[model samples]
Target: MTSQVEKRLAGLGLELPPDWTPRGQFLPFRKDGVLVYLSGQICEWAGEVTHTGPVADTPEGIAAAKEAAKICALNLIYRLREACEGDLDRVDVILRLGGFVNCHSGFPSSPAVINGATEVFIALFGDDGWHARTAVGVSGLPGNASVEVDAIVRLKD
Candidate 1:
């Protein structure tokens, strides 16, 4: 049966990425009791990195970062689904998210760039998606991705 979360994703014209492999030597998510911790997900689509390079305030850079953030969110959602055993309705709460943006030294718009991923969760889960978040600017990220996102999620006990 299609889960409510799946329905919501469909409603948003979003689909889970086909591949959920970890980008490096780590599990995609680790579950402890009811809490599931997701590893950082870079902006990738169909097994290819979608965006790379430093984020700047320029219109093009911002647009690219936003797109990258969205892709990371999509990847994170897929991990969330996996954590729930393929049933997104099992998600009880979205606890937190940490976003990292590769940018020029001292860039101040990391939060806005990470919002691309933040907005996706809010759109998918509504109030339940609201969570504490941290957005940091970094000189580089694994794969040199423009944005990387990690999430903390809760599942029904």
Candidate 2:
């Protein structure tokens, strides 16, 4: 069967980089029966973080960070599909998402910010895309990047 993850990536002109090892002895993903918990993924590509600094400090950068979050979600999908032997449809429920905005205390727009992933997930998975999500502002992100996101997806029967 054709992988929508692969085809969508091609349509979007992107390719998932290899799995990234977690910092401090942490693992990136853990599966229990039918659900997979993916550790938070930063908006970095090839070890290079696309942007940094708080949204209040960097407006244009914040806009870019929103776009980057969506891309990060796509990358997550690719990794999940690869792990499941190339069947994205086997992903029955993309149950939850947690997004981080590496921003200062005054920064706002978190819901719209996380909409980056929300929008993409819907486009990709249709009604199955609905998910519980958290959009949080933090003092800083692991790599000082402006955004990061993680997910929990329930595998199909």
lDDT tens per residue, model 1, 82-110: 88998999988899999999998889889
Over 4 Å off, model 1: none
- Candidates in order, TM-scores: namely 0.96, 0.87
Off by over 4 Å in 2: 57-59
Candidate 1's C-alpha lDDT? 0.90
Lowest lDDT block of 10, candidate 2: 53-62
* TM-score between candidate 2 and the true structure: 0.87
Give each model's whole-structure lDDT: 0.90, 0.76
What clash count does candidate 2 reach? Answer: 0
**Candidate 1 lDDT trough over 10 residues, lowest sum:** 15-24
- Give the winner by TM-score: 1
Which tens-of-lDDT digit does each residue in 8-119 have in candidate 2? 6567675666655554466667888999898788777777777674655455665777887886786677567765767887888789999988887867777667788777
